[model samples]
Target chain A: MNVTTVFINALAAVCLVFALIKDTTKTKQALKIAIISFFRIFPTVLAIIIIIGLLSGFVPESQISKIVGENAGFRGVLTVAFLGAILHIPSLISFPLAASLLEKGASITSVAVFITTLTMIGMVTLPLEIRILGKKLALLRNGLSFIIAIIIGLIIGVIL
Target chain B: MKKMSKEKQKKGLVKDMLFLGIILAIAIILLLIFPEKKELVISSSKGFFMEMILILPAVMILMGLFAVFVPNDVIVKYLGRSSGIKGIFLAILMGAFPTGPLYVAFPIAAALLKKGARISNIIAFLSAWACIKIPQELVELQFLGLKFMITRLLLTILFVIVMGIVIEQIVLLSEKTTKHEQTS
Candidate 1:
C-alpha cells in the first residue's frame, strides 16, 4: 500500500480503539449518526459521479482540447469558466480531468478557470440550494460565483 | 438516565441491524451484476479503495468533533451581516485552512445559516476555501510552478470577495422586493 493508504489505515485503527474504550452509548450514537448521514448523502453523490463518468466517456478529449486551446483565446477562457460553473463538479474528479485536458492541449488558463469555477460555482446544485436556503441567498451566491469565475479566468489568462 | 440508556441501546441495536442488512443487500446485488472474478476484484479495488482513502474514517471523526465544539452562534454572529467585510475576510481565512471533506462543510454551513450567518458570505467562504486551500496550493506550486500557483490563488481570492459582495446585494434587493409586495 502507498503511504497515504497506510496513514489512513493507522488513523482508522486509532479511532476504532478510541470508540471501543469510550462510553458504549456514545459509541453507538456516533455509529448511528455516521450511517444515517452516509446513506442520506449517498444517492446525490452517486448520481453526480455517474453523470461525470458518462461525460468523460462520451465527450472526446480532443474536442475539449480544441475548444480550450491557446488559439481559442478570450472566448475559450470564458467558455471553459462557464462550463465549469454549470458542471459544479467536485475537486476529486476535476483534478484528474484537468490533468487529462492539459495533456490533450487545453490552455492553462482554460483549465485553471474550469477547475476554479467547477468548485466555486454550482448551476446543477442551485435548485437544491434554493430549497434548503432561500431563493434570495441561492441566487446571490451563484450570481457572484459566476461573475468571479470569469474574473479569475481573465486574470489567469493574463498572468499564465 | 437508566431508562434513557436502555432505550438508546435498543434503538442502537435496531439501527445496526438495518445498516448491516442494507450493506448486505448492496453487496449481493453487486455480486449478481458483476461476477466475482479476478478482474472484478481489481476494478473494485481501484475504485472503492481510492475513494475510501480520501474519505478516511479519521477525517469523519475529526469532523464530528468539530461539530460538537464549534458553536453556531459564534459563526453567525462574527460572520453574520453586522460584521461586514471583516466577517467576510475572516470567513475566507477560515476556508483557506483545510479541514475535512466537502460533506463535513455542509453541516457546519447549515448550522451557521440556522444561527443567522448570511448565506452569501457562507457560500463565499465554502467555495473559496474548499477550492483553493493553502495546503493544497503549496502542493500545486511544487508541481505546477510558483507563478501559476500564485496567479490562481490571487484570482480565486478576488473572485470570492466579489462574489460575496454581489450575493449580499442580490439578497438585499430580493428582501426589499418581498417587503414591497407584502405592503401592496
Candidate 2:
C-alpha cells in the first residue's frame, strides 16, 4: 500500500483497537456502523472507479487539459464550480475522483473549485437548509460560498 | 430520521446500481470496439479500486467510532456556551470531529441558534461540518496528496471564518433595519 493508504489505515486500526479496549459493546456498535457506511458508500465508490477508468482510458490527455487544464481559464473554472454545486456526490468519493481528474490533466483551479462547491453549496439540500436555517441564512451562505469557492480556486491555481 | 434516511438509501442504491450497470455495459461495448483500450481501463480501474479498498474501510471505522462516542448533545451543549473567536474555533473543531452528513447538522445548528449561539459561530459550525470533516479530510489527503489537501484545508478554514463573520454582519444589519422601521 502507498504511504497515505498505510497511514490512514493504521490510524483507523489504532483508533479501533483503543475503542475496543475501552468498551467491547461500543466498539461492536462502531463496527456495525462502519459496515453500514461501507455499504452505503460502496455504490458511489464503484461508480467513481468506473468513471475514473473511462475518464483515463477514453478521454485523451490533450482533450482534458484543453478544457480544464492550466490554460482553460476562468470560464472553465466557473463551469466546474456550477457542476459541483449541482452534483451531489459524497465528498469522500469526490477526492479520488478529483485526484483522477488532476492526474488526467485538469487544472488545479477547476478541481479545487469543484471539490469546494461540491462540499459547500449542496444544491440538492438547499431546501432542507432553508427550512432549518431560514431562507436568508441559507441563501446567503450558499451564495457567498459559491463566490469564495471560485476565489479559493483561483488563489490555489495561482499559488500551486 | 433513521428510517427516512434508510429509505433514501434504498432508493439511492437502486439508482446507483442502475447507473453502474449502464456504465459497465458501455465500458464493455467500448472495449469490444477498441480492444487496445481494455488494458488501460482495467489497470486504471484496478489501481483506484485497490487504493479505495485499502483506505475506505479505515475511514469508515473512524467515522463510526466518532459517531458512537461523540453524541450530538455534547456538541449542542458546547456550542451553546461559546462565542467570539474562541467560539468560531470551537465550532470548527466540533464540526470537524462529527460523523454525520451536513443535513444532520442543520437541525443542530438551528437548535444552537435557539439556544443563543452567535450567528458567526453557527455559520462557522455548519460550514466546517459540511467540508472540514475528519474522515473526509483523510480521504482527501490520501487521494489529492498532502499539499493539495493541506492547502485547500487552510483556504477553506480562512474563507469559512470570513464567510461566517460576514453573514453575521449582514443578518445583524437586516435585523437592525427591521427593528428601526418597527420603532419609527
Candidate 3:
C-alpha cells in the first residue's frame, strides 16, 4: 500500500482500538455504521471507477487539456465548475482524477474550480437538502457555492 | 420519519446500482468495439481501484466513528450554544472532521437553525464539511502535492468563510424585507 493508504489505515486502526477500549458498545455501533455506509457507497464508487476508465480511455489527455488547459481561460474554468456541481463523485476520489487532469495540462483554475464545486454544490442531493434545510437556505447555500467556486478557482489560478 | 428515510435510502441505492450497471455495460461495449483502448482502460481502472481500495475502508471507519461517537445532537447543541467569531471557527473546526457527507450535514444544519444558531455559522459549517475534510485533504496531498493541496485548502477556506457571511447577510436582508412587506 502507498503511504497515504498506510497512514489512513493505521489511523483508523488506532482509533478503532482506542474506541473499543473506551466503549465496546459504541465501537460495535461504529462498525455497524461503517459497514452500512460501505454498502451504501459501493455502487457510486464503482460507477466512478468505470467513469474514470472511460474518461481516460475515450478522451485523450491532450483533448482534456485543450478544454481545461492553461489556454482554456475563464470559460474553461466555468465549464469545470459547472461540471463539478452537477457530478456527484466523492471528493476524495476526485483528487487523483484531478491530479491526472493537472498532469495532462488542465489549468489550475479549472482543477481548483472542479474540486471546489464538486465538494460544495450537490445538484443530485439538492432535493434532499431542500427537504431538510428549507428552500431558501438550501438554494442560497448552493447558489452561492457555485459563485464562490469560480472566484476561488480564479484566485488559485493567479496565485499558483 | 426514520422509515421514510430508510425507504428513500433504499431507492437511492437501487438507482445508483442501476447507474453503475449501465456504465459497466457501456464500458464493456466500448472496450469490445475499440480493442486498442482495452489495455488503457483496464490498466487505468485497475490503478484507481487499487488506490481507492486501500484507503476507502479507513475513510469509512473514520466516518462511522464520527457518526456514532459524535452524534448530530451534540453538534447542534455545541454549535447552537456558541455564536459570533468563536462559533464560526467552532463550526469550521467541527466540520473539518470526517462527518459523513454534505447531505448528512443538511439535517444537522437544519437542527442548528432550529436551535437558533447564526445563519453565517451554519453556512460556514456546511461549507467546511463539504470541502475541508481531513481525510480528503490527505488524499489531495497524496495526489496533488503539498504546494497544490495547501494553496487550494487555504483559498477554499478563505472563500467559503466569505461566502458564508455574504449568503447569511443577503438571506437576512431578504427575510427582513419580506417581513416588512407582510407588516405593511
Candidate 4:
C-alpha cells in the first residue's frame, strides 16, 4: 500500500488499540458500528467505482477537458456545481473520482466546486433537512451553500 | 421513532442496492458491446477499489470510535451553552467531528436552535460538518494533493463564515417580518 493508506491504517490501528485498552466493550461497539457502516456504504461505493470506470473508459478525455476544462468558463463550473449538489455519492468516495476527473482534463476549479457542492448541499436530503431543521434554516443553509460553493471554487481556482 | 428510522434505513439500503444493480447491468452491457475498453475500465476501477478498501476500514473505525466516545448529546449540551466567537469555533470544532451523515447533524442543529444558539454559529457548525471533517480531509489529501486540499479547506472555512453572517441576517430579517405581519 501507499503512504496515505499505510498512515491511515496505522492511525486506525493505534486508535483501535487505545480503545481496546480503555474499554473492550466500547471498542467492540466501535467495531460493530464500523462494520455496519462498511456494509451500508459498500453498495454505493461499488456503484461509484463503476461509474468512475465508465466515465474514464467511455467518455473521451477531450470531451471532459472541453466541458469542464480550464477553458470551459463559468458555464462549466456551474454545471459541475449543480451536478455535485444533485449526486448522492459519499464525499469520501468522491475524491478518487474527482482525481480521475482532474487527470482527465477537468479544471481544478470545477473539481473543487463539485466537491464543495456535493458535500454542502444535498437535494436528495432537502426534505429530511426541512422536516428536522425547519423550512427557514434548511432552505437558507442549502441556498447559501450553493452560492458559497461556487464562490469558494472560483476563489480556489484563482489562488491555486 | 427508532422503528421508523430503522425502516427508513432499510429502504435506503435497498434503494442503494437497486441503484447498484442498474449500474452494474448497464456497465456489463456496455462492456459487452465494446470489448476493447474493458481493460481500461477494469484496471482503473480496480486501482480505485484497492485504494478505498485499504483506507475505508480505518476511516470507519475512526468514525466508530468518535461515535462511541464523543456522542451526540455532548455536542448538543456544549454547543447549546456556547456563544460569541468561542461558541462559533466550538460549534465548528464539534461539528467537524465524525458523526455519521449530514442528516444526523440536523437534529443536533435543531436542538441547538431550540436552546437559543446564535444562528450564525449554527450555520458555521452545519457548514463545517458538511464539508470539513477529519476523515474526509485525509481522503481528499490522499487523492487531490495537499496544496489543493489545504487551499479548498481554507477557502471553505472563509466563505462558510461569510455565509453564516449573511444567512443569519436574512433569517433574522424574515423572522422579524413574519412577527410584524402576525401582530398587524
Chain A alone, TM-score per model: 0.59, 0.95, 0.85, 0.94
| lDDT, candidates in the order shown | 0.59, 0.91, 0.85, 0.90
Q: Let me know the DockQ for model 2.
A: 0.66
* lDDT tens digits, residue span A26-138, model 2: 98999999999899889878988988998999999999888888888887898899999999999999988898889999999999999999999999999999888888899
lDDT of 4 at A134: 77
Compare candidates 1 and 4 on DockQ and give the better one. Answer: 4
Model 3: per-residue Cα lDDT over B1-184, one tens digit each:
8899899889989999999999999998999999999998888888878887787888888878877788777788799999888888999988887477788788788888888898889999999999999878877877777788899888887887887788889878988888643110
lDDT of 1 by residue, B15-91 (tens): 55565466445544555675634344335334533553355344444334333333445555556554577777788
Q: What lDDT does candidate 2 reach at residue A79? A: 86
Write the residue-wise lDDT of candidate 4 on A1-160 in tens digits. Answer: 8788888888889999999999999999999999998899999999989998999899999999999999999999999999999998889888989999998999999999999999999999999898888777789899989998999888888888
TM-score of 4: 0.95
Candidate 3's residue-wise lDDT over A55-129, tens digit each?
Answer: 888988789888999888778888998899999887877987887678668998899899999999999999889
Interface RMSD of each: 8.1, 3.1, 3.0, 2.6
Q: In TM-score terms, which candidate is top?
A: 2
Candidate 2 lDDT over residue span B12-128, tens digit each: 889988887888888889989999998999999999999889998999999999999888999999999998789999999999997877899998999998998999999889999
Query: What's model 3's overall lDDT?
Result: 0.85
* Best candidate, DockQ: 4
Order of models, best TM-score first: 2, 4, 3, 1
What are the TM-scores, per candidate, against the unseen true structure?
0.57, 0.96, 0.91, 0.95
- The parts of candidate 2 lying over 4 Å away from their true place are B180-184
Cα lDDT for residue A82, candidate 1: 82
In angstroms, how far off is B85's CA in candidate 4? 1.6
Better of 1 and 4 by TM-score: 4
